[model samples]
Target: MKVVPLGDKLVVKRLESAEKTAGGILLPDAAREQPQQGRVLSVGDGLMLPDGTRAPHEVNEGDRVVFSSYSGAEVTIDEEKLLILNADDILAIVR
Candidate 1:
């Protein structure tokens, strides 16, 4: 399905959590923390500037990003989980 975010919003697909820790110990579902990393699926048009020129967002499609744990609204699209958040909610772009 095609998704288009409006007004500086971003659509991201959450990455799956690791099944085990660095020590190779299995982690229970309830013990796992919410994922803060995701792949950018869509980005909205640039935000309006005071001078009337739109300032484009730094993020783009396919960019891997990290966000606040509580950021964005969780949504399910076509049975696939996705997040919808404002661009300001994204903390950083992963290398």
Candidate 2:
């Protein structure tokens, strides 16, 4: 299945967390936190402005981005975790 974000929204998949510590100790799932960084999978066209024009989004698909930790809605499709968040929730794009 494919996901397409609506206006001003984005479909992102979180990047994998570190599996091991610096000392090479493997970290269990219970010790890991949900990642705040993700890769953009799909993006909405843009936001509609009051002047009846569309404002282009700052980030595009395939861009790695950092977002607010508590933002967005999560969903699972075919066991794949994904997030749907507003473009505004994105803090920065990874270079």
Candidate 3:
């Protein structure tokens, strides 16, 4: 299944986090925090402005980005978990 976001919204898939800590201790699933990193899957054209102009998005498909915790909505596409976030929710793009 394919998802096409609209108006500065993006479809992102969360990247998996390490299960173990730096001390080589394994953390239980309940003890793990949700990952803030994700890969951009699909993007909308851009945001609409009141001036009748659109602002281009800084993010693109296949880009790794970091967003704020508790940001965006979660959806299940074809049984795969994905996030729908606004462009403004992204904090930084990973190099």
Best by lDDT: 3
Residue 80, model 3, lDDT: 97
Model 2 lDDT per residue over 3-28, tens place: 98889999999999999988999999
Poorly placed runs, candidate 3 (over 4 Å): none
- Against the reference, the lDDT scores of all candidates come to 0.92, 0.95, 0.96
The 10 consecutive residues of candidate 3 with the worst lDDT sum are 52-61
What TM-score do all the candidates reach, one by one?
Answer: 0.91, 0.94, 0.94
lDDT of 3 by residue, 4-81 (tens): 999999999999988999999999999999999999999998999999888999999999999999999999979999
Clashing pairs in 3: none
* Residue pairs with backbone atoms closer than 3 Å in model 2 (clashes): none
Off by over 4 Å in 1: none
* Residue 53, model 3, lDDT: 88
Task: For candidate 1, write residues 5-88 as lDDT tens digits.
Answer: 888899999899988999999999999988899999999887878898878999989999999999899999899999999999
Candidate 2 stretches with Cα past 4 Å from truth are: none
Ranking by lDDT: 3, 2, 1
